[model samples]
Target: MEMIKIENITKTYKMGLIDVHALNDVSFTIKKNEFVSIMGPSGSGKSTLMNIIGCLDTPTSGKYFLDDISVEAMGDNDLAKIRNKKIGFVFQTFNLLPRTDALKNVELPLIYSGVSSKERHRKAKELLTNVGLGDRINHNPSELSGGQRQRVAIARALVNDPAIILADEPTGNLDSKAGEEIMEIFSELHKKGATIILVTHERYVAEFADRIIHLFDGKIVSDENVPKNNREK
Candidate 1:
């Protein structure tokens, strides 16, 4: 199934008298349960594309369909609904609230969705355990290690059971070993039928996906499947 479909998408921003083309006629489709990576250098429109894919921003022109629903025509409220119900975001900076415990952080999306307090706590705790943070559920962002905090972020991302996991530089802030461990968790998620779209500049990180889409100057330069032999075992 096509989880995400875009065609001839374009995004333009006005900087004074100049119109900056962040994305120019870009098109691609990501299938259900496919693990894909997007790679690009700075100023390559990677962030712009990610924002559009996440429904945080809309394109200036062209078509975008998520799960067969037209996204280009959605208003702010509808977009917010899609974001909360269909997409889960994982950011590099571990966007957990400084004052909230890991369990509370994980329960945020549920609170937005109007889930019951008892159910929210149950799901959040389950996800924290799954992410190997069962004992650290009471820890705040400042109390946990970089890796543990990211793990909590990941657990939060999964708490809502979103259709897609949109991760932006998820391991960017961690040490090599911690980053590897985070990638391993992502790998395990993919194996469990998650549709993951990861955006990163690092080759090793990008290679974690089964396929990679490379962007340059607001256009797709290459889109190819990772060779089986080239993938890490």
Candidate 2:
């Protein structure tokens, strides 16, 4: 049931004459349906690790297995296919196309997968309804509030029924109330057996996850489970 396994993962960047180590021998395992949060301050390698885990970037040297398959062995085309099918990403900026309506935004993944128009419309509408945006499916990103837009993003992420939901600072742009609402949605998703990996520096936000992995200067500093009492109810 190990959804992700990383061993001695290292990522080095070449900058002019300097070698920058983004991740240094980091290792971890995340089981299926576990909610995990990765925390770090700026330049702490959180982004680098997220990129590797999301299959957007390869580790410079290490072993990465997704669902028991070796990610390190995948070609670029294979990686792209895997990313589209297995990993769903929710970004801080809500990455929706401003010109597209909510329904189209959510249907983007299915479209890429060559899902029939009728089937795509059905699935997208259902997901948007589940996320509390059924009535606003025709609204563009520009016409919706920040929270509503984020809901659309969440719906889009869930459209593919992906094995893992990689959410990076999903509430970063929201106000206190809106952020809490977004977290509530994530909590619901977790309850329903979604495997979510959230990256955030906010302690309150990180607390939503069942476990936290703290990163500093490209290495894991702490990895621990949250006490039941500390978790959001």
Candidate 3:
């Protein structure tokens, strides 16, 4: 069961008269329930690749299939539907609404999907509890610790039961302890059968994924499975 498949994908951007190749002939497939990471330095095209995988951007050439559905032809409205139903996103900045409480932030996906108010509330509470934020469900992002805010973000990402979790630099802002905590939560999610694709520049962060795909100069330089001994679990 291939959850993501891309073939010879390319992304080109024009800055005035100059052309920038963000991704060049990249190809890969991620299977259902697999945990994979894309590792690269700044300006190495990892962000561009992440955008394409998350349906936030389209390739200039080649094909993209998300759960066997062709994404190359989807319009903005269609992409929004797929994003709400099939993809969950966690960003380094903890992209939560500052004015909202943790529970409300976590219910965003459900709200977008037209879930009933009562049910969405229940699901948000359950996910917050699962992520160890049960005691702080009513707190605003300002009231929580950095790690706790991220936990809220993780809860929000899972609120709608998305088929894939796309985390971009998810642990980039955290301290060592907090970063490890986030990775532990991700490991737990993978244990429960979620397909995860994370993009990061840190080796330790990338190591949390079962496999690491190294990107350089808009190309895959290496794709290797993590050894059992190297994994956190």
Scored by CA lDDT, what does every candidate get? 0.94, 0.94, 0.93
Local lDDT at 125 for model 1: 96
- Across 45-147, the per-residue lDDT of candidate 3 in tens digits comes to 9999999999999899989999999998799999999999989999999999998999999999999899999999999999999999999999999999889
For candidate 2, the per-residue lDDT at 222 reads 100
Question: lDDT, candidate 2, residue 168?
Answer: 96
The regions of model 2 sitting more than 4 angstroms off are none
lDDT of 1 at 59: 96
Q: What TM-score number comes out for model 1?
A: 0.98
Residue pairs in collision within model 3:
none
lDDT of 3 at 191: 95
Task: Summarize candidate 2's per-residue lDDT along 1-233 as a digit string, tens digits.
Answer: 99999999999999999999999999999999999999999899999999999999999999999988899767898888778888999999999998999999999999888899999999999999999998999999999999999999999999999989999999999998999999999999999999999999999999999999999999999999988888945
Q: Candidate 2, residue 91: CA error in Å? A: 0.4
